[model samples]
Structure formats: structure tokens, C-alpha cells
Target chain A: MTDPARAALAITHEPEGGLVLVLRGELDLAGLPGLAPALDDVFALPRQPVVLALDDLTFLDSTGVSLLIRIANHFGTVRTRGAAEPVRRVLEVLGLAGRFGLGEG
Target chain B: MVTSAPRRLSILVGVVLLLITAALSFLAWLAHAESEENLLRRQLAQVGTLLGSQATVLQVQLADIGQVAVATDGNPSAFAAFADRQLTETGQSLSLWRVDGDDMEQVALQGVPPLLPDGGADRLTELEPDGRLVMFGILPGEPRRLAYGLMPGEDNTDFVVYGEAPLAPNGRVEPAEGSPLAGLDLGLYLGEDAAPEQLLQATAPVPIEGRTETTSVPFGNSTLTIVGASQGPLTGIQSAALPWVVLGVGGLLALGGAATFEFVSRRRAEAERLAAENDRLYRQQRGIAGTLQHALLPAVPELPGLEVAARYVAGEDELQVGGDWFDVIGRGPGSCVFVVGDISGRGLPAATTMAALRFAVRAYLAEGHTIEDVLARLRGLLDIETDHQFATVLLGDLDVPAGRLRLVSAGHFPPALLADGEVMLVDCPVGTPVGVSPSVADSAVTVPVTSAATMLAFTDGAVERRGETIDTGLDRLRTAAGGVVSRPLDGMLDDLLGALVSPGNKDDTVLLGVRWG
Candidate 1:
């Protein structure tokens, strides 16, 4: 595994067996350049249920929001399931969490 | 890249070229004139040499005593002997002669006619007497058209010969073979009526200097006159070369001038285009900032029975558009809901967070949530909805009939109290900025509408900044709110915003004011 400073993804698995991603800065047109690789890792994992937490995220713009929606839409519940409360809220605000079946179910 | 240097260099080069061309043209013209002068001078020298040779021949023949006496006394035998000797020695053509005596009588010797023609006797009698012989007549019956005359010498009693020689080619005489003037026109003339100045003036001036030479040679017994004039007009060859040189140089100069003009004009056009583009980009950046600020704020919500007024001011600096917002919701029965919030940070992200907070407050209020419950729910909603972006807000419900105001403060500034021509700050407990935590603790404060006249709620940016602390802003806000408390609430809001929030406020400032009788 390669470690790059502020490399687009910084994920730490919590003691409760959930993944917590700390997105400290902003996600704008500039930040979109390296986000694809991190998101790919999330979708390529096994079908086991996992909580994708975005609690440490300080800023998320429309570009970031759109990427989240596209991930959930493309990978329906059969392959990917469960997400943290904050991430679910962002998806609901964008009106896509229900379609992906990732909230409360 | 400095255009002026190249431009000046080009201009300097052009001036130098102009001066050089002028000097060259003047020199060329001088050379042309000099060439013509050389041609004329060579011709004159040749003519002078020929005249010298002719005079020597005549002088030798005249020195012969036999030939002179025979020609003067009209002796055929002596003339025949002299003519035979001259033919054998000099190979010259023997010509006409006239003799004058001391008695002013003249005689024609051999080589003259045997019988006089109609006007021949008068012509022969016209010679001068006293041994100063004079002769002048036109020869006839020959293609050469030669004329000859002889006058006697002053003291020696000898005669003089005057003559017009035949033209070699056309009317001009030709120089001898291998002469410097062999191909030139040597039109020499000598007489009292001939003007030397007129001939000299006909030729163009040239720079050559050798003084005129004079030599006297014998002709019969009198001296033959010889004068050389070196002058002639410029030939076609010299005069024709100027126009062609001028045309060629002038065409080159015109082409260079036109190209330089076009290059300068094109650069000027490019400069104008760059300036216009810069102006357009500046304007577009300004518009983008303004749109972001507008998007974050709430549209003014209409509330019944309560005179609610709000004003928002955006900073003037280009990079400083921010997130400050206010909203009023009508809660039915002469009561209404009001809020003023400030999102953390500046620019677009702050604006987005403010938008979420504002809508969340309005939605909770519409669902019949109490003022305190609405604040709690809004805190929870933002904690979940936003990443870490937070908003500081004050939410209140006004009961117009009950004459009471209930409010929940989430780390927001306390409201300003206006009463009896004085302004005071209403004391309230502060809470943490909303969305900082999932469970934010908030404090509810209630103030009676009795004798309070007007209440003003505002974001920190309305009366605060980096220089002035929160207390100083509160004091300034209180003073401003005192003057307008007696007037209508909407006008008072305008006056307060006009006084404290804008034209100079360096951040987005949101203000909401309400009054109840």
C-alpha cells in the first residue's frame, strides 16, 4: 500500500468494525481530481454490511454530493449496504438514499 | 518587449537612410554633369590642335617668298611653280587669294577665276588697302561650300587669309584620329558677333579646372584668330538615368513605410483586445461572488400582524461574499416566528451550510415545533446533514396577543432592547454553535413585550468584525436601535441597517427587527 500525504482517501477502521473516513478539507472542483480512486475501493469490497462514516468531513460541495449519489445508484443494495447517519442525511438531502436502500433498512 | 525602443530604432534607421539617399542622389547628379563636361573638354582640345596644325601649314607656305610675291603680283609662272611645289610637299588643295596694293587697288592672282562673273568684280574690290588686305566672299559651284579671304599685314605689307572650313559630319567638325575628342562635337566659332558666354551657359556645370590656352599662328601674312569654348548641353544618356533611380528607391521606401504602419496598427489592436478581456474576467468574478451570497440567504418571509423587517448586506471586497441569513415564519393567530443565523467561514461553502440551516429551521417551524424544540431539532439536523460546517442562530416566536417573546439562542448574540428613548442589551445564556455536535445544549429566554417597544435580532456580522469585539458591537447596536424604536418596525430596520450594517460593513450582515404595540 502506498501512503501519500493527504492522499485523496484517509480511512481508519473503527474498533466497532466500521470504516471512518476523515475528509478534513474542502471538496470542490479542485478536490474532485483524486476522489475516484478512494470511491472505487469502497465499491470493490465484499458484500458484507459496512458503515461508511463521513463524520470528520468538514466540507462537501455539490460535486462531492453528486459522486456519493452515483456510487449508491450504481451499486444497489445487493452488493453494498449500510452507511453512517451523517452520510445517510447527506444522501437523503440529495434525495437518493431511498433509491439505494441504504437508510434505516 | 518594450515597443518604444524598437519603434525609435526603426525611426532612427529611417532618418539615416533618408540622409544617405539624399547625399547619394546629389553625388550621382554631380558625377553625371562631370562626365558631360569631360566629353566637351576633350572635343575642344582636339579642335584647338587641328587649328594649330592648319595654321602651321599656312605659315610655312606664306614664308616662301616666291609663293607670296607670285600670289600678290599675279604671275602665272610663279604661281604654277609654287602650286607644284606645295602639291608635292604638303599635298594641300590650292585655294583662292586676293592681293591689295598701296594705292588701295586689289588684284586676283592665279587660283582665282580667268573671267569675272556677274558679282565677282565687286567681291574682288572689297579687300582692304594699305597692305592690310581684307577679303570676304562665299565660294560657289562646289559641294564643300568653302569660303576663303586674305587681308594684307599691317606693317609687312603681307596679306591675311580668313576661311570657313567644311563640316565633317552634319554641321559639326570632327576631331583628328585618336584625339581625346574624336567622337565629340567641336562647334567652334570666332567673330565679333559670336557670344562665348551663350555657349558656356548652355552646358551643365562640372568641376574641372585648366586655364584657357592661347597660340598665334600665321595665315597668309595676318595672324589667324583661334578661341576654344568648352561647353555643351547634357546628352540624353545622363539626363534619363535620374527618373529611373528615383522611381526604384521611392517604391522601396513606400513599401517599407506601409509595412511599418500596418505592424504598429496591428499591435495597437492586440493591446485593446487584451484590455477588454481583462475587464470581462473581472466582471465575471464579481458576478459569481454575488450569486453565491444570494443563494445562501433566505427570501424575506411574510408574517401577519407583526411588522417584520430584514436587511442583508454583503461586503464590498471581491473575495468576501459570505453566509448571513434571516427568515420569518407566520405561526398563526397574530404570532410569528423569526430567526437570524451566521454560518461559519466565508464564501460558497459557508453559503451552502447557511442554506441548509435556514431551510431546516423553516421546516421544523412548519411542523409545529416549539421555539426551543425547533432549535434542538435544527442542531440535530445540521449535525447529521452537514460535515462539520456549523451555524450560530437565534430563533424566536412572537405571541402578538400575549405580548411575549420566546427565544432559543444557539451560540448567537443576544437581542437588542429598545424602550423609553434608550437601548439595552437583553441578557441571555449562550449555547454552542449549531451542527458542532449531535446534541447541542441551548438556552431559552422569554421577554415580555410590555413597554419594550421593539426588539432586534441579528447575525454577528451585522455589528461585529475582526477589529470591534462583541461587546462593542452590542453597544453600537443598542445606540442605533434607540432612535428608530418609536417609528414603524420596517423603517427602523432600514435605518438600523443603513446606520450599523452597511455601506462599510466588511462581511455579510443579516438583521431582523419586529415591534408590537
Candidate 2:
């Protein structure tokens, strides 16, 4: 439903013992072509305890904030936290302040 | 200091003294004039009485002259010898003229001399009709004469005695033995001049008053002419001691004005210096803010298959930088880790912590560690790196292909999930913020992933402040994010950021959202 050309998703590991995956550039209606498929791949991961660290993300609109929320709800027992300031604020504003924590080892 | 004060005070005193001196000098001049006037008046009074006494003495001498002349019956020689003897003893001028039937012959040459050499005898004969004696002579500058009338003679012959006197240079009538004006410097005019005495009185030609008495003022001519002067009394006194008062007052005012001016100038300068320093400090703070802000924020990263965006805003207050960070790292195909956290405090120190935490998160994610293991590692890293710098974070693992998300909370707020046009807060148990505890409980949450569903993650700075309940701010956040309930993940993230972050507060905010469409 969204354009894939502008959508992108990537991940890295934090030295503090967690995985930091960054969504760069835009995740919007014009970018859904690439964004939705990336979300599908993330849901396919087989890891039991994964920590997503969005420390270097540059932009996240409401669509992006909801995507993280869905992932958080999907992994209710996995324990989610955001390392970046902008990502944390969006989550907290959505009344999901308790689900996020520091990413450290 | 005391010496300088006194010196300044003395200068003030000197100025006052100078003013006083001038005032006293003027007053003294006036007093001197008044004193002189008084002295003149006293001298005039004394002179008036002295002239009266002199006129009486002359009358006594003249009476004797007439008595001798009449008793001898034209015995000019006998009268002449007697007049000479009287004149020598009294140090005055006396003349005896025998009027032998209009042939008036002067027979005595005593202290009196012939009138100037111009009509000496003729001037004596040119007397008034009732004149006892009238003549003129020069002893000082003006000639004076004494007149006498024949005392009730039984014989048909009249013999009169006349005298003239010389006035001193100072206009004093020579004082007789008993005169109050004796030895005083004053002028006395007793005889009538060319002008009639009555005319002089009516005209009030001079300043003195005329006194008239019937008592015989014995002139040497056995007659008296009333005497007075042409001036009033004078009084004055002189002293020198009053200018000091004016000088003293003037000096005090000058010193006071100078000292006050100096004090005001110094205080104004001090205030100006302080204001300048304050301005300088403000500018330096601004520079620090600009540099610190740019330093902590991440440069946008490039990824694929997902529209990802992030923005970090620094805190506005100069105290420090608010610690909010975001990170995204790729794991395997269709899998990524998203993390956001808030470090405590603001400004430089918080910025420092933010950098350390950001790198730590990157390191842990690269190591391919689990969420709980990552949090513990991050906590240990912070304890080592910052001597226990505390922070709250939320880390997530996105399984995009499977449409699932696994998240771990480290004392951070929960994330939001927008599924099927409905907004839900994905509740997860919070662990202590990293660096506070040595380790975290091994607990995590799993949320059902749906296609096109958006997940929102953030730090507490997005919803926390003084006088505000965290719950209230969270409610506002949910409401704002819920408006774009069905947006594509990236668009929804933008809408949420715009709704929640207030630009007025400069605190750092980090937000990351992902969706499976």
C-alpha cells in the first residue's frame, strides 16, 4: 500500500548486549512499498530474546511509531526499549511508556 | 584614609572661610562708616558747647572793656592799656574804639590786628544801626569781630569796646578755661557771617540745627550773637571678624558635592561591568548549546525495505542536555533492532552520557545479544564508563517477515501499537534504568505482528516534567498518536512526533517506529 523506494530498515548490535536496528530516511505512505515488506521480514525472526536498539534513526512519523508499537505488542514477553530520544518520546506519548527500557549488557 | 578625608574636609572648610571673610569685610566697612559718623556727631556736639562758652568769655572781657571806657570818659589811653593787659593774659584779641561823636578812634592794639590792609578802619565803621561793634580781620582765613553797646550812660556820650578773634585752622573756636570741647578736633562757628542768621535758619542751608537762647553770650564787644552749626551728629564703630562663617559653609558644600559625584560614578561603573560580564556569559552559553546539540544527534542512516526516519532535539535550557537517543541496527534478513533511551540531566554532561550510551547500544546490538543480556551489558558499560550514569531505554527486535516484534524494557516507558485502526498501549514490565542495577531480570514481551501495523517506541523525555504526572503526559501522547491510527508506519511516526514534541522545551527526544505493511 506504501511506496518501497523510499522505505528502508536495517539493524546492528549494541556493545551493551542488545541488537540495534535502525530505520533510516522515511517510513511513510509514499514509502510503504519497501516498509511493509521489511516489517514482514522482522516478524519472521526466530530469535527468542532480541533487543531492538533504534539509536541512530533519523525520522519516524505516526506510521513508524505504530509499527514499533505493534512489534512491542507482538513480543509482550520479549521486553522492548529504545536508545534513541525521538523514538522513546513517540512511544511514551502513545501511553506505552512502561514497555520501553535502557538497552545495555 | 583619615588623613585624606581631613584634607578634603579642610579644603571645603577653606572655601567656606573665604566666603565668610568677604562677607565680614563688607560688614566691617559698613560698621566703620557708621562708627565714623557717630564720632563726627559727638565731636560736633562738643564743639557747639565749646563755642557757646567761648562767646560768654568774650562777653565778660568786653563788658570790662566798656565799663573801663565809660568810667574814664574818653580816656582812650587808660582803656587801651587795660585791653592790652586783658588780651595778653587771655590769649585772645581785644580792641577798644572810642566813639568821640562819630569820630570813632581805636586806642588799643591788643591781640587784634587791622583787617587785612584793605579799608581796615572804614570796615569797622560800616556797622549795622543797632551794632554794638562790628569789624573784620584775618587771623586764619576769615575775619571775625566782637561788638559792645554803651552801657546805660548818664553822660551824652557813648564809649564802646570791640574785639576780634582768630579761629584755628580746624575751625575750632578757641575754648575758654571751662569748655567741654577742649582738646578735641572739631569746628565751631559762633559769629554771624554775610548772611543774616535768621535767613540761614529759614533756609536750613546746612545740616546743623540753630539754637537760640536769651542768656547773654558775652562777646568781647559786651554783646552776644546766638551760635549754632550746619551739620548733624555722626556715629560709627569698626571691627574685623565675620568672613570666616561664609567661607566655612561654602567649603563644606563643595566637598560634599565632589565626594557624592565620585561615589555615584564608581557605583555606576561597577554596575556596567557586571552587566557586561553577564552579557558575555549569555553569548558563551548560546555557543555551547549550539555545538552540544549538534554533537549528540545521530546522522541519518540508510536502510532498505522499510521507511525509517529519526529526529533528535536538544534541551533548551543551558543547564545541560537532556539524554534521549535512538538507534537502529540490522540483524538478519527482514530483522532489525530498534532502541531509544533517556539519559538523566541536561547540557554537556548529559550529552557526554548520551554519546557513551549510544555507542554502548551499538556495541551490544552488534554482538548479537538478547534484549535482557544487552541491557545488563549496557548497565555494566555505563557503570564502568560513567561511574554509574543512569538511563532508561527500550530495545526492540523486529521480525518483519513473520509480522512480529519482541521488546525489552530497561526502566523505560512502554511503546504504542496501532493495529487494525485501533490504538493500544503495549504494556511491558519495566526493568531498572541501565547503570542503576548490576543486572536485569530476564523478562521480555512479545506482541502479535500484523501486516501494515505500526509500533511506536520512545524515551521518557517525550512525556515527563516538573508539576506534571507522567500518566497525564502519556495520555496526551496516546491521544495525539491515535489520530493517525491507520497511517503507514513512517507517516504515523511523523504525525506522532509532530503532535507530541513541543519545540518550546529543548530537551532531547528520540523516537523510532516500524511497521509491517
DockQ of candidate 1?
A: 0.03
TM-score of chain B of each: 0.61, 0.54
Q: What's the DockQ for every one of the candidates?
A: 0.03, 0.02
Instruction: Give me the TM-scores for chain A across all models, comma-separated.
Output: 0.51, 0.63
Candidate 1 overall lDDT versus native: 0.55
Candidate 1 residue lDDT tens string, B1-517: 4456556656665666666666767777777667656655555555556655665564455335233553456454555566455444221234334444432223324343323323544454455433332223223333222344444434444333333333222223344587544443333332322233211111112112232222333333333333333433444654548644854595467458645755775587668668777877765655675686676555666666556677777766535466678887777866888888876555666677777777888788778788788888886766523453556778887886888878777657767767677787777755655654422355688877763466788875665544334456667787778767787777887888777865655667777777655
How do the predictions measure up, each by TM-score? Answer: 0.54, 0.48
Residue-by-residue lDDT tens digits, candidate 2, B1-517: 4235545655665566656656765675567556655554555455445545665565556566667766787576877677776654343555666555546677665664644324544444444333233324233334333222223233543555555544333332444555543433322233443223211111123322433211123333433333333232233111322233444455565566656655655566667778777878765665575476567566655555555666665556433456577777876666788888876544455567778877887887678778777877786666412342456778888887777788888667778887777778887866655654323364788887776677777765576553455666688778887798776656776777777777666556766776556
> Which stretch of 10 consecutive residues in model 2 chain B shows the poorest summed lDDT?
B198-207
Best by lDDT: 2
Every candidate's fraction of true contacts kept comes to: 0.00, 0.00
Off by over 4 Å in 2: A1-105, B1-290, B316-318, B330-335, B384-388, B438-440, B484-508, B511-516
